[model samples]
Every structure is written in C-alpha cells, then in structure tokens.
Target: MKKLTCTLLAATLAGTFTASALAADYTFKFQSSDPAGDKNFQVQQAWADRVEKMSAGRIDIDLLPVGSVVKHTETLNAIKLGILDGHITATSYFSGKDPAFGLIGNTVGAWSDTTQLLQYVNYGGGYQLMTELYAPYGVKFIGGSTTGVESFVSKVPVNGVADLKGLKLRAPEGLVQQVFAAAGASPVNLPGSEVFTGLSKGVIDAADYTVFSTNQKAGMNDVATHPVQPGFHSLPLIDISMSQKKWDKLPEDLQEILTTSVRDFAYDMTTQLKIADQQAVKEAQANPNITIHNWSDEERKKFREIAREQWKVFAQKSPNAEKVYQSVTKFLEDNALL
Candidate 1:
C-alpha cells in the first residue's frame, strides 16, 4: 500500500511540474486586416504554427485575421497602441502613413512579373528601405511577400490607355493614386474591406488590387464584367509587422523563433499566391459572365511609361526614396531585367 501511494504521488508531482511549465510559456495575439482563409491569414497562421512547433509550444500565437476586431486601415495604429499584437499589411495600404512604403509596390508596374517583384523587393534593398521607413513609427518589420502582378478590375472593358481616362478608381496608396491621377483618372481612397461594395454600387469604376485570388475572394468578379490580365501591379509585398514594445519584450530565443517564422510565412504566402493566381485565372476564364481583357502592346507601353515617370518622381521625393529607387534600378540592371 505504501509503494502504491509513493508511485501515485510521484505521478501527480510530475503532472504538476508539466502543467506549471506550460503555464509559464509566452502567449501572443496576431491580428490582420484579412479575414480567415485569406492568403495573408493562412501565411500568418502557418508562421504561428511553425513558431509554436519550433519552440516546442514555448510561444503561443492567437490569430485574429480579417480585421475582426479592428478596421483594415486601422491595423498598424492598433498594433502601435497595443490594441493588437501583429498583422500583415500591403505596402500600398500602409503607405498612407509614409509614401516610401509604396515604392516597391509601385515601381515594378503591371508588366513586372512575380519574379521581378520578388527580386526587386528582397534582393534589391527594398525590404531594408521599407523597414527603416517604418522604424520611426514603433513597429518592427518582419518581411514581405509578393502577391503576383496587380491588375485593374473594371466594370467597363479596358483594352487601352484611352479606356482609363476620367475613370473613378479605388486607389489605396498615395503613390498608386498619384499614378492614377497622372494617367488622367480619378483616384479615390478606400479600404480593402469596402472595395467590393464600392465597385458594385458604382461608387468607383475600377480598382487596382493585387492578384486574382484576392479579387475573387472579395467578389470583385460579380461586380466587374472585365479583368485585364498581365496586371500592371506586381505581387504586392504584404508586410508582417509586430509592435516594437512587444518585440523588445521577447527573449532572444523567442525573437529568433519569430524572425525565422516570418521567413517561413513569406515563403508560404508567395507560393500560395502564385498558385492562387493561376487558379483564379482559370476560374475567371471559365465564367461566361466575366470578360478577360488583354492589354494591347501600345496600351502596355503607355502604362509602363507612366510607371517609369512615377518612379522618377518617387525617387526625387526624399533621400530614402532615392536610395530605394537606386537599389531597385541597380538590381534590375544587375540581373539584366531591363
């Protein structure tokens, strides 16, 4: 009887120790503007999962995606205020805080393929430039993921530049809006969550969101009759950011786990977006109600010209912009991309 009692006590003690250790583990919340099933949401979840597994559950991430608790445009400030812990944002969306954030997203243009977009942002010093730009705002930059080329979604068919003039369009970022204004289009600022409703109601005639997957998810297809391919925008580099205060509070091992997890997130998002874009195109083509508009060479040239001009204006705006421009230019030249 004494032996049995000793064994039971030992088991209880071991269980208590394990429970105590778990209770002492770190916990955090990850928030995003995208809802569940969003590519960014999936990527964020994958990252969280990777971190938890890698740390053996020493770090726990509670994911809140799709702006469930906060508005999409308010996510950055929310994180800064500690209202949320982390999130993924597009350069264009976040660029409202600083124009420099849009450089990477804008420079590549609609003709810039996914490879070009990734090369420009990752190897071209785009990420470092972006991180430095956001540092002053009390946010820690994790990295970015390309969303595939951005294209115009229109209710009216767009086969050439002439078709774009005077069109009321939803432009999320400052630089992108400027690009639209330069092209003689009316640029309106709106949140991602409102885009579909706005387009359906004719509140805006067009939108330049990244990739087909996002648009289809947003139900842009139902409202817009046409989608122009070889999108003028590149895969937008969605940024994964954490509040500086929370980041600094983490232990070195935890920080390492997070940074590594972010890299994994980037990879997952990039791969998923690539696959999504293809699937989206296939689905769009199959829909009889949707018209897939292909740009004429002349129209493509005109758009590229606008993009190049915008790049020059962008570089001239600030020293940081110039640095980012020079880095991207050098990278493009180095790889013979031009």
Candidate 2:
C-alpha cells in the first residue's frame, strides 16, 4: 500500500510540473514619443493587442506614451542599455548619434508622396539600410511610421520666401532647421510638447509643427493666424525601432509576430493620418482670421536650391548622411521623379 501511494504522488508531481512549464509566460513593453491620446499611441496599443492574441498567453505587451517611461532624447540610449524593449522615435533625435538615421528625416524632394516613401523603405532597401545603420549601436530598425510632413505656420502673413527671413521659427533637426537658418531665420529647437505654449506666448513667430491633424490638435491656428501650403520643408517618414538585445532574445515566433504587426500598424497609421490631415486643413480654413498661403512654382524651386546646398554641407560632415542621400536619390531616380 505504501509503495502504491508513493507511485501516485510522484505521478501527480510530474503532471503539475509539466502543466506549469506549458503555462510559462513572456511579457514585454513598447514605448513611443506621442501621448496616449494621439492616434499613433492608439496604433501602438493595437499592436500590443494583436501580439498578445497571436502569442496567446505566452507573451504580453505594455505601451508607454510620450516620455512617460523614458525621456524622448534618452529613449534610444535606454533601449540600447536594455532599460526598455522597444520604442517609436524620431529619426531627427538620433541624427547626432548616426547621421544615416536622419535619412528619413531629411529626404526632401525625393519622395513626392506617402506611397513612394513606403515603397522605398519596404522594397527599395531603405529599411535594411536603416537597420544596418542602427545595429552597431545595439538597436534594430523595425521599419517606418507616418507623422506626415512638417510645413510652415505663423501668426503673421507669410506670402513668400522673402517673408521667412528674421522670423523666429521653431524647427526640428535635419534639413528644415538648416533651410530656415540658411534663409536667415532664428530656428529654435523645442520638443513637440512645448510648441503650443511657445506660440501662445510669442516665444516663436512661425513654426512647422506636424501634419495638419496633429497641428490642429496642437492648436497652432489658435495663435498662428496664418498657415502656409505646399509644405516647403517636408518632414515625413517617422520610424519604429527595437533594442537589438531584446529582439534577439524574443522567441522566434514572437519576433515574427511583432515584425508583421508593426509594419501593418505603420501603414494603417500613415493612411489614417493622411486622411485626417486633409480634413483638418479644410476645417482650419473655416476660421475667420486664419489665412492660408500656397507657394508658387518659383518659390518651391528656390527652397529646393537652398536644400541642395545644405545637403552638401551635411554630406561633408557625415558619411552616413551621404549614404542616405545616395539611397534617397536612387529611389527618386528609379521612380523617375528626378
């Protein structure tokens, strides 16, 4: 009887261990520079949801928005040091570390449309190049996202290039800042969160915040009575990335799951933002005091000329910058846009 009882006990212990092993769980977190209420933030949450369902209970994900979990500037470093699993960061912020990362940030005139940018990154080796550039720093580029283009907006009338000089403009990194500085405007560097307050208080005279939808949300029209068109400084192509260490450690199945879902999220986000941007512009036009200005062909050509010279200086400073320029140029030529 004692021997029989011991045999049954061992069997029960073995069954418990097997069940526990089968139920093992893996959880990870993802972060972005946008706030929770932003569309991009919602997309990140959607990604997490899809990933969890695909992985069943074996994998879990959490979303961190804005700089809530990590400072925007420090996000890349945090992920490199293994402080976070993944993040959606601007190519501009990382330019100081690797100018090649600025390829998407500064690729003006190369991509005329969102679809073209998407094709180049996913199919034209841009995506692979981005990953290679980030690899040495212990980060992995996980394709792209859409923040739409950065165009000019102001409280005063800006009818031409001549009007841009001497204006206090808020500019992000890459060609946009360079263009404004070259044109003699004092380009201030401020994060996205501070633009509204800066404009309201007259800290900036003109600014290029974001897509029409996001800019509307930021209330750029509230203080800036005039908004410009043709998006002189096109700042499109935001990217999503991962910590190399964390990515490699993920189960092969989990990695595959994220790889597919993130790309889908990116495409969806871009399309949605584009639609919203168009509508926002129309809505902004309804306001009585706001005036919209469209650039002439001659005016557009002048901006491009200034950009060409600026690109030369950028290329001279960073080899990565040159590589990105070449890649974008190739894409443009292949598409016959050049």
Candidate 3:
C-alpha cells in the first residue's frame, strides 16, 4: 500500500500542458470514468501517485474524475487531439465505435471472478487484440483495471430473470444494457451523476453500477434498498490508455515505468476494493433498511445463459466484434469458465 502523502492534482484539466510548464519531465492530463466520490476514483489518484514514485518524480499525472475534462465517453478523442493525455474508462462506452469494444469491454456474465478476465487480458491475446483495436484511433492500450465483481443496485428484489421483466434500471451502457434488455428488463441509459437522484426521485428502479463498496459508500442502499450480492452481470475492464504520439516520445525506461506501475495499480485496486466490499457487505447486513439478495445458483445460471446468447449476437455486428468474440470465448473455454 502506498502512503497518502504522494500528491497528484485531480481537477478539471481540460487543456494541454507541457512539461515546460510543470516540474516533471512529462505531465499527463488523465481522466477517469469514475466520479470523484467513487472509491475507484480514489484508487485512480493512488495509481497516479504510484506513477510519480515509479518514475522518480519525472512524470506528473493530473488525474481528473469523470466529466472533469470531457464527458466519460469522449476521452479517447480528447486524447487523440491532445485535449487530454489519457483515460481510465470502460471499453464498452466505445461500443458505438465497434461492437468489438462492447464485446471485449464487459463480455457480460463471462466472469465469475476478476482473475479470469485479467488472465485473458494479460496473457490470453486480449492485450494484443486490444492494442490493434486502439491503434487506428491513435491511442495505445496500456493495461486494464477492474472493480472486482460488481453488485446490482435495486429498489426492489430481483431474484431471477423472471423478476427482471419490466423492471426499469439504469445500466452502465451498451453491452450491459443490451444484456439486461434481453433478460426482460427495461434498461434505461443514465450517467453516474444522475443515479442517486434517479433512484431517490423514482426515476429508475435499479442500476447495474459499480462494486458493493462503492454503492454502499455512496448511500445508494438507503434509497435502493435491495441489492444483488456476488453480482451475476457485468465486471467491466477499466482500460488505461494513452495517446500513441505521446507514448512514442517516451524514453524506454519511462515507458516501462508507466506500464509496470499500471500493472501494480490493477492488483492494488482489485485487492483493496475486494476487502472494502467484504466490509461493506457486513454493513449492509446490519442495516434494517436494506435487503441483500443472493440469487440461487439456478437463477444465476439462467442469467448467464441469457448473456451467452447475446454474445453470439453481438459478434455478428462487425468484423472486429467477431475477433473479440472469438478470442474471448476461447479464453473462457480454455479456462473451463464457459
């Protein structure tokens, strides 16, 4: 664990800044998909701190939370234009670019654990395929991070696919929403900023958002009294990527510092957040206002089946999607996860 004294400026960094204007040899304005209140955002700041230490103060990452410099979905373009240097965001948000992004981004219901996804990304050709996917856009796929298995936020009990029928919920986007809609729920698209108010004001009945710890920490349980534990849906790949042009100019040692620091950050995030999740679960259990739902294996299997069917359908959307679909299924099959 890193000490809290390592500082990284996390603010609205919307313009390009050069090293000449800062103390470090390089200054990257990186944006995260998580809001400032999210624990994931705190972890991101820590990752920035790790980079600074790993680079011996030669790199400065001005980490901004979601919507700080650009809307969460716009960071890839922002990086290409040098409006921002990089992003820590979900790949599924770019599903519109290619269903490949959606297929690889969440692979909805494919992961019962995060290690399965990480194993694929780091060793199962996912890294190479993702690198190729990003090349055309002038971005370099650095590495991926996760929030562990996510928990569902709900205002009502959802025990099975049958329970999802007509339930209106705000899914993160694209792949997740498509899966839920296929499972018989009415999936609404809403940004993270609006979720709490959406639930409190009766705008939506549920959400497929972040980890149990994050939802609990955000007081989401107070309004959305029922939550699904050991989430059976999405476990997103939080992609860390930089501008290809920026990456090319880095010294080999500096490049190593950035990539290696990100790998360490991924492990750090998964470990710490899982610990926080366990603690939050206990807190939720003690709260009278909340109901934690643990779906039976049979119910979970049913949801997984629905998700698998959607995977094949998505693969047909584009050539790139087919590539992602094929590689991902092979990984799951080889790992005996399918």
Q: What C-alpha lDDT values do all the predictions have? A: 0.74, 0.75, 0.88
Q: Report the C-alpha lDDT of model 1 over 1-338, residue by residue, as the tens digit.
A: 99999999999999999898776277777676676876767776777778888888888888887767787777778887888887776656655565566676456453366666655556767667777877777888876666567767899987887787999988765677777788888989887668889998899998886577778767787799788876764456677778888888888988887776766676677678778878888888888999988887677778767876888897777676777678777887787755
Q: At residue 149, what lDDT does model 2 achieve?
A: 60
* Candidate 2, 240-265: lDDT as tens digits: 78888777787788778777876887
Q: Show model 2 residue runs off by greater than 4 Å.
A: 1-25
Residue 246's lDDT within candidate 1 is 82
The lDDT leader among the candidates is 3
The collision pairs in model 1 are: 34-66, 35-66, 109-232, 110-231, 110-232, 110-233, 147-235, 148-235, 150-233
Query: Number of backbone collisions per candidate, in order?
Result: 9, 0, 0
Local error of candidate 3 at 54, Å? 1.3
- What order do candidates take by lDDT, descending? 3, 2, 1
Could you tell me which 10 consecutive residues in candidate 3 have the lowest summed lDDT? 7-16
Query: How does candidate 3 fare on TM-score?
Result: 0.90
Worst 10 residues of 2 by lDDT: 103-112
> RMSD in Å for candidate 3, one decimal?
8.5
Report the error of model 2 at residue 318, Å: 2.0
| Clashes by residue pair, model 2 | none
CA error at residue 167 for candidate 1, angstroms = 2.3
